[model samples]
Target: MPIRLTILIVAGSALAGCSWAPPVQESRTGQIITAPANPSGVQRGPHGETSPVLLTARKMIGVDYAYGGHSPETGFDCSGLVYYAHKVNGIQVPRTAAAQFRFADPVPRDALRPGDLMFFRTSGRKISHVGIYLGPGRFVHAPGTGKHVTVADHRSTYWRARFAGAGRVKTNYPLRTSAVRNPR
Candidate 1:
């Protein structure tokens, strides 16, 4: 064999061996890649497993509602619940309900999806109340002082009339990690 051709072959083999491989898994925000054991144990809402965001919100149900409270141990206010819900999922959102509404992208009612923020006018003012969409026309929220966090239907007369708008918090997380480049 020619000396030049042999050197070229050896260099090519060395380069191939040195090639860098991507991670086996990739991490992302808002990716619902796992199927959580249905707490209700009953199939409800959209089929398949729930998104991590919604699951986080569901876990907070029954937490007490405290005025201006933001901690789970101390209870949660309307916006506080919103903050906690997204915070647990690694999404940073505005603290106040009104600010959250303004900060997030507007999502139409028809296009509403789980984990989206739903705004309302509880005090007859614009964007006064907020809740997390729980799919199947239901939402989870801290209604008011003395009340515990609860899930209610979106079509209820109170919410229906007071409905202001809805917003979506976007994240970079992939939907599935099994096929993800890097799990972390």
Candidate 2:
């Protein structure tokens, strides 16, 4: 085998076991590594507003606020909406704002992307509320009692004062719809 071919084979084998590595594909000429496509068809990088999690949250706009609720039929709370959206998109997250904040990978406010979590200290706590960033300083969230899920600008006086931080969620494998167990 040629020197180039030998080097390619060795490099490919070295990367095969890295779970965090992007996919490596064998092209006609050589191996090429590329980022995996989001299963929900949302484009990665800058266009994150189209992510399935965001889409799911957007669908809940106008849903009545129900403390501790996590589904459309029962309405949703701030964290419940986040939980439901991430759940449907195969991303498992904590069910409370504080827990979610503690578990997420922190992102700076200046660097927040469209599906990043926007945390707030609304209840005079460390992180009492959360919303999904929708880019351009706007975010979608289920406000408190008597309010509905709505998009609000983070730069607004109320939210700006309460803005605690931001975070990014890593995706897990897409969930299987079947609940039946396979004996095999």
After the best TM-score superposition of candidate 1, give how far the Cα of residue 50 lies from its true spot, in angstroms: 2.6
Deviation in Å, model 1, residue 86 alpha carbon: 0.8
For model 1, how does the per-residue alpha-carbon lDDT over 1-184 read when each residue is reduced to its tens digit? 4554355446544643464232243348654454543433222345664557666666666667898877667778999988887777787777888788777778889888777889998875757888988776789899998898778888989889989888877767422112211111
Q: How many backbone collisions does model 1 have?
A: 8
Give candidate 2's TM-score.
0.68
Model 1, C-alpha of 82: deviation from truth (Å):
0.6
> lDDT of model 1 at residue 6?
52
Residue 42 lDDT, candidate 1, scale 0-100: 22
Predicted candidate 2 versus true structure: per-residue lDDT over 108-134, tens digit per residue:
998877788999998675789999987
Q: Report the error of model 2 at residue 66, Å.
A: 0.4
Give the count of colliding residue pairs in each prediction: 8, 0
Prediction 1 global C-alpha lDDT:
0.71
Prediction 2 global C-alpha lDDT: 0.75
The RMSD of every model to the true structure, in order and in angstroms, is 21.1, 17.9
lDDT of each: 0.71, 0.75
